[model samples]
Target: MRAMARALPSLLLRLLLTSTPGALGTNPGLVARITDKGLEYVAREGSVVLQRELLRITLPDFTGDFKIKPFGRGHFEFHSLSIHSCELRGSALTPLPGQGLSLTISDSFIRVQGEWKVRKAFVLLSPAADSKTRIQARLHGSFDVQVKGITISVNLVLGREPSGRPTVTAPGCSSHIRDVEVDISGDLGWLLNLFHNKIESRFRRVLESKICEMLQNSVTSDLQPYLQTLPVKTKIDSFAGIDYSLMEAPRATAQMLDVMFKGEIFNRDHYSPVSFLAPVMSLPEQYNRMVYFAISDYVFNTASMVYHEAGFLNFSITDDMVPPGSNIRLTTKSFRPFVPRLARLYPNMNLELQGAMASAPFLNFSPGNLSLTPLMEIEAFVLLPSSAKEPVFQLVVATNISAMLTFNTSKITGFLKPGKIQVELKESKVGVFNVELLEALLNYYILNTLYPKVNGKLAEGFPLPLLKDIRLYDPVLEIHKDFLFLGTNLQYVRA
Candidate 1:
């Protein structure tokens, strides 16, 4: 089973990067849509990143000396200045249609704390005494700085890297600081307050300058690098891996954003192309859900082809595999009534059936249902007392299997229901017998034995092709004319 978890940050980065001008505008096998409602969710998540990066901003230390001719001379230094906490009041992420995305953060607050030390010398020259008197004072204390009404705006431009990977660059970023307050707490703290105007002005200038720098670094250094590190191909299991390469650049509208993926499955060891091509898939214009994914029949067909080529669609059945207390048995006695030659030729001998799929199964999607058709060849042999076996007959079976698709938070599962079964005689060792009679026996075997085993495996559904750390919520799966539409909101959890 595969696990379906997508990192929200990766999705946003892809969308932002691919939404550049001059998109390919080709139809995709898989289409992922982010609606306006989803933008709100993204903004909330983005604010968390902004706050964390803002706390990492490094401000230069303040060191200088000042002279007051009549009063005295003073030297002060503020060191170890750092942001201790941050609070984001509001944030918005807006789509720019043909351009890229705009991120705005307003009215945020940051608290900074550091140590300040000052030394002052007061001198007086008396004319009568003709001697100079000097008084020196030194003060060291901790200062708290609060910056409020901090606004940051970033314009993300979309472009492609030399390697054809999507890239996001911040061409414009600006910041403003509305207020800065400083408080000194220590011995002679009141005297330090005398220079509060200068201290506040210096704090405001440093913060305003570094805010935009931090925002740009968050995109180019942090987000873009993470995006580049995401794998274009992900392994589903040992047998196969899924290709999530983009079919074309993404398209953005006033209401939503769309990203197209190749959505093909390939063999792990030997890659082979499927006979059929991917049909065009289109998502419905529904904005109620935060995200929507449209998966074409090509995805399932390619998987079927891969598994079939790997010899996974073969099985062997013997008498031991039959259910207990059943009238049916894989011995000559079971078929003696229909073919007397079986009993006369191999009396009381056991029987074994080996089945292999004739070709890769094909899946079809209709208005409300999904069905699979598989053709198989089964050979039956009679076991000899000397540990030898004699071929009794070979039969070809064709079946139509329908399933009701359902999904939980992580995976999509199905409950298969048998539809129609057809059987024909290919070869026979025993005297000619009615093929209809054999079909009846085989039908009973399938309904009573084979389906139970097959459905048991089907219940353990494969994981969806979502990235890590994301889970679907309130997922609704709908079958369309050649594809499946999954609409759901997503929850991102940090690992």
Candidate 2:
């Protein structure tokens, strides 16, 4: 039994290692959830579109011939059929499992008015003479049409295009017209009333058919093209660009829609994938907000890697870069107390600190906390009387920083505060000196100099991938293990 148990453990390990990629293995850097509230918001916007488009419907002009019992045959023609007004009473959008979205519109009404013309033929017979036919005068007037209790149902199939953009298509669309009332008035209004059944039936069929046709056209032509215009790849700066491409078709459920994105950063001039893959990330089950956005640490790390590879992490700090009115200055005279050799070798000369990141910075997220670690090397130099620089010493600085992240409508910003700092002298041309003596000076320089510059740049923040004319409102951000969660509602503003 013991031998069999050992063999089973080995088999299980092999199975786990060879498992196919599934929900637990798929790691998307960015995820977005649109809840029922978001669907309702979209439905409200769709109501306006539905109303406008329905009002633009033009029912086909209808012509028919009717027989008057024992009198004659009359022909009528209705033309210039146009909708005068429309009112939408209710609308809703719902998600379907394994399909897409369902849009339902109910209790809508429209008023249509048109012009009509009728021609009647009357026969008169006398016993003494042959039967004679008399043609009555042509009658023309206006008619009013009222179509109420209108309902429209459409299915929007969400998909992805070849270029990684989202697509919307209404493959199945149908409309229900509950009631259509037609009123005819003219100099022979009573005659037109005799054929009311035919007129009303024709009107109902035309309205129902035209309404669905207009809706299908609007979805395919307007909504689909608009979705294709989404910015999938946007430049973050001159050096790097961010990829917000959809990974696959969105997953639709009864309550929400889930979309995954390849939130990777690449070099703008020369595109290359980051070395690491994104870790699996999941969002909370709460749906209090209209929408929720989840971002993984891989997104930020890729950005760091891109910028570092572009050589942007190297910088030179001079005395002038120091904050104004600060006691700490980047001069050999100021460093004399910490390093006596620096003062003796380069006396009264201005100092410069050239720093380069040893590697890309790393960001870690835990529950309610975010931490950043960066390792860099700094070389001290003194400006000679002839404007040349002489190396004094080199030190490697490692820092742990805690960041407080905040987001606005367009961007995510962070404020990094230093937590623990470590410094070591890597090389010394002046002479060997106690590194501990320079700790306080380095701390002051970092706090008053390096941090301020970094914080200033961070305050500018990075842009978020959002659609045009859409903004987040009432947003709340939370930090989770290996990811960040943002819950908010959306607002559409016309530009």
Candidate 3:
């Protein structure tokens, strides 16, 4: 599982770098939104408090037999010992992706200044108490437990329980315990004073062990299961999967950590020849809080392929669809008023219109406009009343369309808006037949109905690939010769 976890990000990165932009857009860029959630820390003043909270280090009351050759034997029971005040210096944390975290914590000193009472204790070879009698005892001591240089390192790896939730596993924990000085003052004080060196040596070892144990337990209990799955949930409405991968290790600077990534959209149905050979660039440090994207033309081309495969580009204009009072006036020498009626007299006088791209659609991104131009073949066919099935009038019109793009943000998605559509005809069969009839119907349907229908379809904008709970801000967009740049601030959407 750990090896698989390590390899998943690499696989995702390959997909992102290899896939070319298809029907989704000309360019599909990665969405790297980093937040200070899993790996976090406090500094200086607040860190000490955080450390204290994480490891209270409250030792239970222990009663046991204390024996030494020179000091003799005694039954001793000690009261609870706890750390009261501490000086926290600083802390740092680095995340290990799916594994866990590496933590480094510092503290100037931890003052374990608490009262400890030992009762029913007696020492052999001592003048104050008899050897056979387990005399009742009372002792109070103040100990200054100090760590030299006060640097602690811990590595917490994550493991799962039976319930599938994540739990922390402390693989390594190291803390240096420099000195423990005990000032003994109480009944039978001479016995303690005599064995003080041995007592301090034993206490230091125990304290070090307790500190490590307490930290492991505390951190494991406090760690949350937030790094389970990193998903890019958004995609074009028609696209099925995400193509994204980490470009390199996360780059940490003074103020923020930047995760450099690359992504592209893919279409299983549409094959694209474009290649993304550009090297993954370093993250720019200009914006502290930003998401930067660069979209290529392959994404847009793939989306066109998907639309064509789905038969969305094919449309029809029937007799009933023409406005009630509208007329198709032919401009030939024998032009007649009833020609429009005669055109509609067939079982269904309709133009079987089909639009197809002559070449891939070109998407140009600018400050406000996202324009698309697809060289197209718009064919119109009219069926005669006398003909069985085939149309008597067949004409192919070559044209191109331009439109402005708009977009809106939803709870979990952002999609494009296609509006302000304009169609420009490049070539048409005008003088061959009654071209006026075909032209009138094309204008009436293409502008009045087809454009609106296309707009309606476009209102369901392409969903930008992103993660859930993320909110993208207004983007600062820029266009270059080969790519488009989009940068925005991002955050978790507030409930």
Candidate 4:
């Protein structure tokens, strides 16, 4: 056995990981007890946040429900028992402070089912809306509950706000996200009513708001000012969801985003781009729902895809002069280097990623939950040479791509000689190269400014960058996804 261990490669060693307490694939359901306990449910449903942990959860009953074990029948449910990252984070016993809670999770699964109900109780929220306040959360919720092996199902309820209050509630909140409602007892002005207060220092709140506000300003001032009117011109746009309303200002929101260049940039004149409909769908249905309902802070009413820069990628271009319109397939078999973009969207608190990110400004604070690897995306664009007669090149869409690629020809009208291709992104620390990094790097190629001398001409061959060039961009081999997005300037090269 010892000699066999000696022959093992480092990859196996990493997979071995630190010896956790449990046996290999132990059923968490085995740890359940008959005592009361505190439970915090952090679940997302499409886009709503639900925070109400019910009573009990035990695998003693229920059919088709897979319990904490896979090899076994693995079917169970619980209440007043919230589970986080598999193990119990914390819980609030209803009516009475409960004791031990049931915590079960399957690492391979994306959703957890639950059944639950609540008795009489009142949850008073003292939202510290002071300018210096921020809101933090400690919750307990249950998807379902059980009493003596029977499922006690309950419908999620949302009571009407008092008639006098102007509740600005938007639809589509993420389900798994638990939003805390703050009820201020005193009268306050509009400006002062903007935020909730946490126990953190006063300066902390100011800093966060100030930073987000400053970012808002920087977008408007810097990136948007220089964009010209037509390769279909418009200077102002958004990046990383930050609005940069530069030049002859367009409306502030997507509802108002009129395609002014419509009938003009047609058919062959269009800049055909195959982009990702990439939904940040991995988020727990609860959190996804919570983001939809309760998380205005995480999203915005004026959300627009003004622009998104992805990279700081270090993936080496193995072959020089990759043929144009040719897809560089990175399958788990051919290219084990590719990472998935799913995990980068709804990052969990843990999970260290390694690879590259174009920009990773706030990654240190919170790593998003979007994590998946061995995935594929389709992002292709063309740079039309600036001649009265447009160039017609055959685009052979490559097969064997890892993921689905959707194209809406209307959104990206034809591209004429673009002066400079501006890609704004941040760098990743390799937390999950899995993809967000590669996705970021691809920006340098997709509709990017072709070699200025290449002068917006679509190169006839593949445009893969030399592997060495990838390294110079401050590649991150280990880090999270949120902070990855960097700014890049790439001139088209026909290599």
Among the numbered candidates, top lDDT falls to 2
Question: Backbone collision count in every prediction?
Answer: 3, 0, 21, 164
Worst ten in a row by lDDT for model 3? 329-338
- Give the C-alpha lDDT of model 1: 0.78
lDDT of 2 by residue, 100-142 (tens): 8999999998999999998877666676777675858688999
The C-alpha stretches of model 3 lying farther than 4 A from their native spots are 1-120, 123-132, 135-225, 232-239, 245-262, 266-285, 290-301, 323-348, 366-369, 383-495
For every model shown, what is its TM-score relative to the native structure?
0.80, 0.88, 0.56, 0.14
Candidate 1 lands at a TM-score of 0.80
Candidate 3 structure quality by residue, lDDT tens digits, 1-495: 999999999998778767854323322244343334313422232255456663477765544566767555665544556776666565766655655456677654665544445554443355666445455555655444344345677876655443322345787799765666666556555666676777666666666677677777656554332322333333555543334444444444344444433344455455454343432333333453345555544444444555655566667655566677765422221223334433334333444455565655556544444566544566544544555334333445443455544334521212333333334434433323344445666666666775676566566655554544555677655544444455666655524
Stretches of candidate 2 exceeding 4 Å from the true structure: 1-26, 125-131, 319-351, 382-392
Report the poorest 10 consecutive residues by lDDT, candidate 2.
Answer: 17-26
Error of 2 at 246 (Å): 0.6
**Superior candidate under lDDT, 1 versus 4:** 1
What's the lDDT for residue 476 in model 4? 18
- Report, for every candidate in turn, its global Cα lDDT versus the true structure: 0.78, 0.84, 0.51, 0.22
After best superposition, candidate 3 residue 230: deviation in angstroms? 1.1
Q: What is the descending lDDT order?
A: 2, 1, 3, 4
Error of 4 at 149 (Å): 39
- Candidate 1, 42: how far from true, in Å? 2.8
Q: How much is 388 displaced in model 4, in angstroms?
A: 13
Superposed by TM-score, candidate 1 places the C-alpha of residue 397 at a distance from the truth, in angstroms, of 2.5
- Candidate 1 C-alpha lDDT tens digits along 376-414: 899988999999878888999998998777888866666
